[model samples]
Target: MGSQELEEEELVQMVRDFIESESPSSPSFSSSQGLGTFNQQPNYLTLQEILGSVEDTEDEVHQKILKYLRNKNTAWKTTNLKKWLVMRLRMDGYDASLCRTSWVTTYNCPGGDYEYIDIMMDNDENGGVGRLIIDIDFKSQFELARPTTSYAQLTDTLPCIFVGCETKLNKIISILCTAAKQSLKESGLHVPPWRGTNYMQSKWLSDHCQKVQPIPRISSNNS
Candidate 1:
């Protein structure tokens, strides 16, 4: 088989093994057990119960995500991160919705140019107010740019959950820290009060970085 096919097969097997390990075995009842015994308050597992048993599933999936990005032959791009996150959040019982991709908005500045947010999440449908905007900074393109002239200048319309991420964990933290500082300076804009506060701003950025783990290196055997 080709290397790509082989890698896919390996990933499939790995996921299968993980699920098998997490699944509970069928309960066995004695032959003499009566229907009355079965009806005597059988402890049936709920959806939450099953999911709680696999609480580490999220971490495992995150590890796999990192592995995929670390692969040299993988065609995955920064935008794929948003797609993966949306799906994973849903899987983890979060009410996540992809509001837009490459959402373009115009700047009323001197250039009157346009900019885009990589991804936006509308949590309003899920009983939450406001939106969550994410900007993936894979190669420091956004990080190295002039914030004064970039979309950072358009904070009024930006979502309070605005976050920028890099592939590396440390870099992701650094970029978010810088973004938080900018948010503090521009807090006078029409943003949510929590987002405007320094403490909450730091929490928002730090929390995002904490959720993002570094990609693991693929072993030579897998290669």
Candidate 2:
């Protein structure tokens, strides 16, 4: 066989290996037991739970979410359940479509204790762009009062969530930075004037909303 044939054979074998093998890193929410079991009062709180953010499970990194909060089965209202389902999808590795009324949560990975805070976006309806979910694991924690289950950890990583297109998601890191600031505000948290909620501009803050902060671009080696 020629070198080209050998390369093709290797690719085929690799594909087969992936199809047959399951990696431990991937998440599977296979439990329907406690899911959507919350009451009028939504129980528990995760960054996603609080924010109502969406994500695409295809690229979502759910493992990064703290373990305990990930498996939360509750009896709650349908409205709240909807929110919970949307958040779980982001952390798990599936993207959701908010515009599609039929796009409800799927329990493909049932039997999970908890979920994450990722939001799915409507590309066509809301600027027709994509969003990115980033869990910013903190290198350090705060000394003040915070959610013990959440803020008690030694490292203080901010769960970063933003919406945009591939090119758009890239151009607007600054916008995402602003959006994070807005997220904090929307959740009734205080921030600096510049760090205020971008959602303040609802007209400007739709599904695939993109807003570049007025801050000038600085070339960071890491960025």
Candidate 3:
């Protein structure tokens, strides 16, 4: 495997290690509780609640990140959004050198094309530098030529995608869903019926990532 692919594998291994270490070995039950009874589900904060919490944070860096993301116009541009995200990641304790924007990697597509990753992060400490590619969608309307690669081609190429994110502001989830379905047609993957659900899009993108070749991280030392 190339350096980039090796890096990604290392990241996956690290995640597996973390999960394994944190997971409980066995379920613990109390004799006093009835057998039929179950533990109450933990209350999770909703998206709005999480955003509200960030907005109300006393930390300067947290507030700055939230303010930057809340800027509607700035968030619409992929370049601007990437810069802000990289900054936020740095503030959140990620290695700045590992996070890159406008990362270019050549793929042997139909006519030989280049894939520009909006934001790529290589969190692995190994010698390899395979990054996790993240694609951001901010367009309010879906265009036929939205992606440089066609839906038919994406079935063959999009598997390298690590994450696909859409802006919460002024975004129509239905339009995004339509685009996703078109891309998955040739890949033999199916989009969930609930197009509006975030989980559906995440699952689809993740599935695509699993199918494509791993995109290697560009060497920073090489100009």
TM-scores of the candidates are: 0.24, 0.21, 0.23
**What's the lDDT for all of these models?**
0.32, 0.31, 0.32
Off by over 4 Å in 2: 1-54, 57-122, 130-150, 153-223
Clashes of each: 0, 45, 4
Q: Residues 86-197, candidate 3, lDDT per residue (tens digit)?
A: 5444455433222221212223111111122323334356755333233232121232333324432222211111232234211224434455666556455654443333
Flag regions of model 1 displaced more than 4 Å: 1-79, 101-130, 138-223
Give the TM-score (vs. native) of candidate 3: 0.23
Ranking by TM-score: 1, 3, 2
Q: Clashing residue pairs, candidate 1?
A: none
Find the 10 residues in a row with the least total lDDT in model 3: 26-35
**Candidate 1, 1-223: lDDT as tens digits:** 6785664455444433433433234211111112333222212112112212321323343343334334533323223444454554454444444333121222321111112122222334577543233432221222223344322322211211223321222333443445544654565434323322232223323322323332332233341
lDDT of 2 by residue, 75-183 (tens): 1222333234344443343453222111112232111111112334456656774454322211111122233332222112222222223332232333334444444
